[model samples]
Target: MLIGALLILTWLILLIRYPAKALPVSGAALIGLLLVGAWMYWLDTREARQLAHLELRLDYAPTRCPADRPLALTLKNGGGSPLQELRWRIAAYAPGDSVNLVETLYDAPRYRGPGELLPGDTWHDCLPLPPFRPGYRPDTLEFRAERLQGSFAD
Candidate 1:
């Protein structure tokens, strides 16, 4: 944005100072602004586009630990990039309830897999869930991928 503002300011100054060269200078500035806009759009949508190709499934394994129910996650990276970081949201809801009973956000700097999840790879692991209110049990749980940042491997 700063670069775009500077380009516009520079174009305006050139137009006022050198009327003869205004046309060519303004054309070049326009091209620079368009290039900046394209780069910004790509940066803004890259994460969302990658996230769309990811699939997540969540289940509870109560028998595995009688005290604290562990969450079982199966993530499939269908995108063309190697996933490095993930932040997701978990929401607990009662049956037929529109409002959520409880919600929590989890950030995993490194996912618990063999390594960075590669494209077309699936990772399955058990993770500890955040504690809910005492005696407040939810019937259904919802999962959403809040952020998925990754890069393509060379």
Candidate 2:
């Protein structure tokens, strides 16, 4: 933005330098438009995008029940493009047969990832997930991935 402002100032200065001592109105307008266009083009080229098959793993790294349980998740941006500070929410569900109902899980840790992940690289995140409901035991767990503004095209 600062550079854009400076360019505009320069253009205005040129226009005032020679009211009718030089160039035509169309010529000046063309130059100003080109400058702004070039700036926008550079920004678009650097903007991050989402590529497919970005692997994400959520696992029960370790658990002791009702006391101190730490959940670890790995986000691998395996695609070619690097994703920005994308807002995504992940929820993990232990099978209903796992924990007890008395343990009310009301909140979980929410965070924002800031590193630039290259292809084949992994980003690790540790979240304090809600306590697992007590029960017999869980055979399978399910997780859902949600993004604030879905796809870039959409």
Candidate 3:
């Protein structure tokens, strides 16, 4: 924006100084600005496409463990592009006696993945969880992928 302002100020000064050359110079400047704007828009759209082409799917496996209460989950890259440095959310819940009730719920902090997840690849890991709230045991667990960032192939 500052550059644009300076260019416009310079153009106005040129117009006042040389009326004969102002028309052609202003036309050239306008074309240059339009080309620059179009180039910027194209770059932004390419970045958006890269983001859209990255997707993920999460699968949970139930297992029994006395101490850690470990939960196994698999994260799959389901898009055309590769994904890396993923952040995820893990949550556990214990259902209540009545329908649609949650007796106990626990949410862990955001989990950062270690390495890149190539296209069509799956990452399997176990999440160690502490015991559920007193008098409540988890009936459902959820693993969600969030804040995804990746690049698409050219």
Q: Among these predicted structures, which one has the highest lDDT? A: 1
> What TM-score would candidate 1 get against the native?
0.64
Clashing pairs in 2: 98-135, 99-133, 99-134, 99-135, 100-133, 100-134
lDDT of 1 by residue, 65-138 (tens): 34444677788989988887666555555556656554343542333333578889898776666545456653
Q: Which ranking of candidates, highest lDDT first?
A: 1, 3, 2
What ranking emerges by TM-score with the best candidate at the front? 1, 3, 2
- Where in model 1 is the C-alpha error above 4 Å? 1-14, 43-46, 65-69, 103-115, 131-135, 138-140, 152-154
Candidate 2: tens digits of C-alpha lDDT, residues 83-103: 555455655555653323223
Query: Worst 10-residue stretch by lDDT in candidate 1?
Result: 105-114
User: On a 0 to 100 scale, what is the lDDT of residue 15 in model 1?
Assistant: 84
Q: Between 1 and 2, whose lDDT is larger?
A: 1
Q: Which candidate number would show the highest TM-score if scored against the true structure?
A: 1
Each model's lDDT comes to 0.66, 0.55, 0.58
Once superposed on the true structure, which residue ranges of model 2 sit more than 4 Å away at CA?
A: 1-51, 63-69, 94-108, 131-140, 148-154
